[model samples]
Target chain A: MILPPPEPQTRRQLLRGAAARTASAALAAAAAPGAGGVAPASAAVAVPAASATIDRLQRLVRVELLLEYCYRQVLSSTILRPDARRAIAPFEGHVEAHVAALEARLAARGATLPPGPASVSQANRFLARRRVGGRLGHLRGDQDALRLLLSMEQVVIGAHFVALLKLSEPALVELSAQIMATGAQHDAVLRLLLPPHKLGSAAPYGLVQGVQ
Target chain B: MVGDGGGASRRALLGAAAVAGLALSGCGATAAPASTRPAPAVAERDLALLLAALELERRTVAAYVAGLPLLPRALRGTVQQFLSEELEHTGELISLVRSVGGRVPARPNSFQLGHPSDAAGVLALVHELESAQIATYLSTIPQLSPGPVRAAVASILTVDAQHVSLIRLQQGQAPVPSAFVTGAE
Candidate 1:
């Protein structure tokens, strides 16, 4: 269940605590000798540009198919509660809608729709890595299923963010931006469902630029 | 959200350049005046986009200003958080305008937010505002040239979309509004 909203006094106290913490961090940073001498730098991995508009759309179509396929597999599991199934239904439906839109766009270009990946038979194959022991079935629990879905949403958001830059056609780029927005919404809601200790906030710090 | 303080002077020069361009176009000499020549389509398009984004962000900031007082204390924090983001967005857009040869736009004289009687009204208003912002950003992305400008707009657009989801959840509605976001306009 969603928690009740904090009281006004509680809100004020929380703000004060946050301010104090910020001040302490600032002071600590200032007092650290020679710390300012070192400069921090970060780099962004630029998403590769598609060869052509059709090529980009075709790649995105494959992504939607993969998402839909994963959602269908999770829905078929017996462990998911009825309410959980109900919630997931619309998400699956939305992915299908995305597939349709993408396919339509591809058809207009006389491009063939890309097939779904042959390897995405189960959730573990998608979620787990060999470096971390082995694949475990995350769909065995309702919470885990939600987490998987959240990760997919983030992946989609990152893809569209890149596509917006690569796409040459104005209308296609617009469509990508719109869909990316929805994907972000999905990310927010899914993040909220995870336990407070697991996922801290509804939104991320800056724009989510993830591609994988 | 802090700007580097150089944009104001640049924007002033841009405004002067625009005015000078217009004035030169009025001359009735035999040859076409320098101002009569159209600015590059790419540059003009970028300028228009920056202006539109500026207007959207400013109006949204105003929406929060008008709507927050009516909301319950519990809901105010969420709105405030969103407001801060919007303010950051406005700052970014202002810098972008100067970067793209556009002058600072006149701030909105008034926002069109309707009266809200309660917390629900405030949230509903927020939902509408966020949806509009999301749509605008989506539609605008295609028009932007591929580079930092487009990337910046997309980044802000994604955040607005997230805001829509959060607002829907508060209303006990499904988080996903639709399968695909369709930016009609």
Candidate 2:
């Protein structure tokens, strides 16, 4: 006789439970009559069109792949100091993990995972365009690599924020938020590495702003 | 909308409805069926989530205050920075709550945070608090109305996550201790 599949892992089960609790609390409050200052839990909220969401995820995947490649380049380049290379390794590993996680998510949904690094040519071109002055973007020194990484982290964070707003699935929203937080940490670490003259006070804003 | 009566029953009903809806939406699908009908003009659910989150931020700020004294002098600045960010988050949340005609809930002068003896204990408290906040924001975002407000919540969460990483790093742990930050419940 065929055996049944194993139960969901504890973490996944807990996430589902939390999502249930949150939904129950919010929906009940919405459904209640004349409840506090809450607006009526009127009609269903809108989510992004299914096609649009898929396309956005695909774009994010491509961007992340490009980031992984850049991180690899910086780590391998002789120009980077030994200490800097060591510092960047964990971050690079995180990017690789992000790409894998995102790919698995897409595959689970029956969506095509865009083929490896070549798919991010547009992102590469964009970074090329972003190169300060006439210097090569990806071939620069430690500070330049850090700047480049900072810019990329900002882009990823912004994309995740937009994705979080549009995604209807609690799991995906949670995933996006988690990655966005990691990206912010990476940005802060990189900023601290730069010279004080180049960087202003750390933690510059009370609220971190994303693309509108 | 906030409710004062029959909360348990209403929550049970809502929970059942949500489970049923999820079943119909399929395993991988994240949203309800597309409707040509216009979306709701007002976001009642978003407002409720914001109000709840605002209260959590207040508690978080208080926790930081309680933990600060226990932290080493070198790390005190870090906790202070986190406290400031939490306060800023509170200010923004207040605006969102007010925008939806919700009343600002009262914040007590002090929130009860367990006493921690040493630096490690203080860090542990902060780690636990940030993890809870991260989970709260993660779950709440999907239920929120899709717009700038949701984006703002996402941004705040990103910063909170950053704070957690900083704390972990200070304690000689990996800045990113997990591949996936949620699912911690």
Candidate 3:
């Protein structure tokens, strides 16, 4: 019997939920008209908007941390070929850099850093919440590992795309786009290393909304 | 005039309608009266950026057309595919510009892209053009308001960066040399 596919865990979903919550709160405020039906000043609106951006930034930090954990796991695995290992080792460093940049941003905002997965079991639990648990342990070959990494990179791209929509600060939006573009580069390179590697698969679409 | 014809036209129509609607609705927020509503300066700025990006995309498309024959037989297919994607980017940008009530700029009859002597020269020219495209999008993203327009620009930027990575791979260099795709390199 054909079974239904598990619901994919997407950062788009998380961001959408966050956006909905923010929208609902705004709507609630709007529904309750101020004295003489006058709208609130722009300064009053700015506070919540700034806090929402911070919340989104914090979520992205958690995502980067989890991704860093996953990258470390795959790098340590013996399933990858030596050449593949050499090519992909830099990606782990990239993810670490992403984490560092995001953490610095959070610290600048005086936001607490979200704790990352500290162990393999913790990482698996994190993945399981997204319905892709035991991913690190499932690697049978180089292709498997590469495919997993490709999917992860796509997730990063999607997350940043969603975050960009609500990010108020232009600098933060620019930083997010820069990071997202790096994820796309990683996606393309990983696709080239996969089976039946072709340039077409490396860049199959002009618009990258990511796996979501 | 610079894209895959019918598809680009249809997308342009849809984009125009969507942007007009967005403008009318004050970006999906509570609509105040026309006099009280603010001017669409943000949309105009986005339109300008999209138009500039569209112009660059058109030139990049032209460069691929001019340089395609100079590439090696094995590399032609890849470059051809990249050409098609560049056309797609133009179509998307055109749609965005139209949606924001901006005039679609006239496509240049020809670009003064430098002549490449051989396959290596062609690759170098393509790389230079792609890098410039990447840099343009990176700078443009921050200026765009936080919305679908910014999202769309980011999407296109990523693809351009991907093209660069593949080109580097073909040149036997590191596919992704940097963690951040600043496009300055």
Q: How do the predictions measure up, each by TM-score? A: 0.68, 0.69, 0.78
Which pairs clash in the backbone of model 3? none
Question: Model 1 Cα displacement at A48 (Å)?
Answer: 15
- Best-fitting candidate, measured by lDDT? 3
Q: Which candidate is the best by TM-score?
A: 3
Instruction: Quote the lDDT for B157 in model 3.
Output: 91
Over 4 Å off, model 2: A1-48, A108-110, A115-124, A129-138, A196-202, A210-212, B1-42, B183-185
Model 2 docking category: acceptable
In candidate 3 chain A, where is summed lDDT lowest over 10 consecutive residues?
A: A10-19
C-alpha lDDT values of all predictions: 0.63, 0.63, 0.73
User: Each candidate: how many clashes?
Assistant: 0, 0, 0
Ranking by lDDT: 3, 2, 1
How much is B101 displaced in model 2, in angstroms? 0.9
